[model samples]
Target: MDEHDRTRTPVAGRVEADDRPAPLPRRITVGIIVNPKHSATLRAYADLVPQLQKAGAHYRSMTTSVERSGRWQAEQLIDWGADTVIILGGDGTIRAAAPVLAEAGTLTSLVPTGTANVLSRHIGLRSCRHAIDHCVRTVASIIRDVPTNLRGIPVNAAEFRRADGSRHRTEFISLAGIGGDARAIAHHHFATGLLGYTWGAARALFVVNFTASTGATVGAGDTSGTEGSASGQVWSVMASKVARPAGPIAVFPQARIDAEAFTVVTVGPIPDRLIARCRAWAGIATACLQGRPQAHPLMDYRCTTDMWVSVESPVPAQLDGDLIGDCLELRVSAGEKKLLVSAPTT
Candidate 1:
């Protein structure tokens, strides 16, 4: 038999052959979590509603605000019987909804409408249009199929507790960090998109005290895998499950979403001179962007399942693009649960 004939499945002795598979018997219900601040997202949603309607799909959408969180909206959707969730924002939005959906085993998707859409881009949802188109197709399927835009995107969960005895645990689907980068997020919270991030980074460069160093400890487990300690003049420390957090820079080149352990990159203890520090920062960034790993006294990289970092003074911290305020100590470990997402497999 030919390729087409062999692939066809007979139903009631009748063969139905087509390039595209028929829609599943049961319809999918989609839950859209939108960031109302973006006009482009609103426009995309407007176009999406009619397409979903034409496709005979059932959907419920809500706007996220400073008061109403994505996690709350996701819970509401789940309560409303939604099995599939679509986030129309960036990493921060995804992180907020992740815990609830992962526990419920809900399939999540993203439209990448916020700043530094690192996770969204890594999963092949490059543009808003691409993400929206995938949503239309997703609502037509009932079962999870590998041939379509469905994937199990792995993410690390972190639990952090402060030295002051206040305990708070949160899940992050993207990069998490302490020091200058986190301070930058706090400074740029008033702005949006790349411009905001740039402004924040610039402001942080001048305002942050780079001469300070923090004590860091990392390990894959209680006693197994890699273990190390560092103390010196420190700049910033970050951890991630992806090769790159934003743009072309592979901050953790050896890392992967599906990997069992995440990679941590530490850059610090450089010359106290501002110009010298700037040169080092630019050089390290350039190397990362080129996907090259080099050995330098000012930089350290390691793969670990758990990391503990503490400083003499509290520094700002951020996870998945959301600031976590000032923290003197942070402990992060890999989570056991893996979230399912609608995206191309890496």
Candidate 2:
């Protein structure tokens, strides 16, 4: 077959000859990984499974538990030959399953069942929370030949090492950070959905310790370390693949999920005086909300492929809204894997 003949539709009601290339499947198989904590996810599953079955598509369902991670569930789906995997939770759920799915080159989509469905909003899904029945119908349509387009978005993976020499790796579909923003995520637990994120950010303003300045160094490559460190007293650093990690709050308005790079935002130390600190953060917040964040003396935003960050001591960290505890070193690289998502319908 020539390069142009990669995709071909088979003749209806007939099988192809052995010498000819096989056509696309008559029906697609979908796998759903649900966060059991969300009752809405359970509701959507009940409504979705029947619709998929009626459309002649095969499907399998798995629930996330305290003992089992999304990675394990996703691996099961891939082994079962799923044509598409539907994640029915928030950014954290997506983060857990995405690396495995991306590595396997499987098509994926989301239903936004958790607080701040940032990926859905970034991909133009708009609504942070969707009705269960509506989400069910949308998933059904996409799997049943609704002519929706596919998008390949970059995923950020990190290798983290603690001051005590323990190590682990993680991936994020939206945003990750070390410092004040992460403190907000750590303190974020009120109401539900976007309001909780807002309340958390508000609560952080009064309690978060901005004095722990990470004398951080940034290197171009992932392997470079702290011997030749840049002398900046950054209070926090955020790296994002999407425009807004918190819904409607644009930390990096210029960010594009489909792009092969990451937008890294760094915040400098707050003022010593109370009034001065208030004014400084107020200015930064205003600029970010307006969708044009100015390069202030205390803050900076830049695009890069990979970055290596080393701090003076253990400090707060987070990935995709989930806290990463304290870390002394972090290496974040973009475009390591790209997950295919169904583009939102216009």
Candidate 3:
């Protein structure tokens, strides 16, 4: 409630870092949102309630499976005098609640329970991927104090409206692109788990590589009839917000989570004459694997405040690590939202 009551937490053992801490509210009315399907999330919720009570906090918990997207639930808690929100799920759950929480002016704590807790690592919370007990205990043990705000990465969120007259909004934390990355995300399945993602990436890489080797040209295009625009044969382009994604492959090391500008890594300008698609894709792949994107001429990584990309084809756009249906053009720029976060203690 006051400067003297603010607590501190060390975060070096974790992968990422946090800048400052927020004072814990005196009343401590907490709103907790969980996803019941994740057994780890359930276990963490059980442990979290006791911890909050022992700390003299009043809390209410709800599962996303029963409450849809948790958007309305978050608003309800805000109306009920809850100043802090604890989300017990993976990246998607946290991301889904982000825009709402930002507008509600509530501080949020993340207990990683899903498959790749990418943003958690940046905020001093690291949960082992798919490890239930370890993750559950980790989530419960880290609510030491009210956390501070996190500088949100900018994203060009695309609206994908379906024929059923329904609309879905998705968040892109790290990278979004066309070509192999998008194709691989489209092929991924939730039931198959991590294996599905690995296979999808592998298949995408090899398929692109083989197609290049045979001198096959994959359809690529840029926009015209708008201001001054330079055109290149675009094979693939990734707009990066963070230095690393879910894995070790640093596709956009130049990108920072809190950077004012995001990086756009493009690979292309394929030869008009017959040439190996394998060679171009391989060069892009190598840069990704080594974390040094400028290693090849075919790959170009640039930082910009805004960009416009016209694919000119109907293809699923990969936002963050998943596909977000079909779209034509992309408008990339800095977002207006700022999300407050409570980073876990060291």
TM-score of 1: 0.84
Evaluate candidate 1 by giving its C-alpha RMSD to the native, one decimal. Answer: 7.1
Name model 1 segments beyond 4 Å from true: 1-25, 143-149, 161-165, 207-227
lDDT of each residue in 236-317, candidate 1, tens digit only: 8888888767556667778877566768877665456889878877777667666675455566787777776777777888
Model 1: pairs clashing at backbone N, Cα or C within 3 Å: 233-269
Q: Estimate the overall C-alpha local distance difference test score of candidate 3.
A: 0.61
Per-prediction TM-score: 0.84, 0.81, 0.72
Clashes of each: 1, 0, 5
Task: List model 3 lDDT by residue over 61-175, tens digit each.
Answer: 7778544766766777788877678788776676667767877657677777776677776655656332323333333433544233344533335444433445554554455
Ranking by TM-score: 1, 2, 3
Candidate 3: list runs displaced more than 4 Å. 1-25, 128-172, 206-228, 269-282, 344-346
- Which candidate leads in lDDT? 1
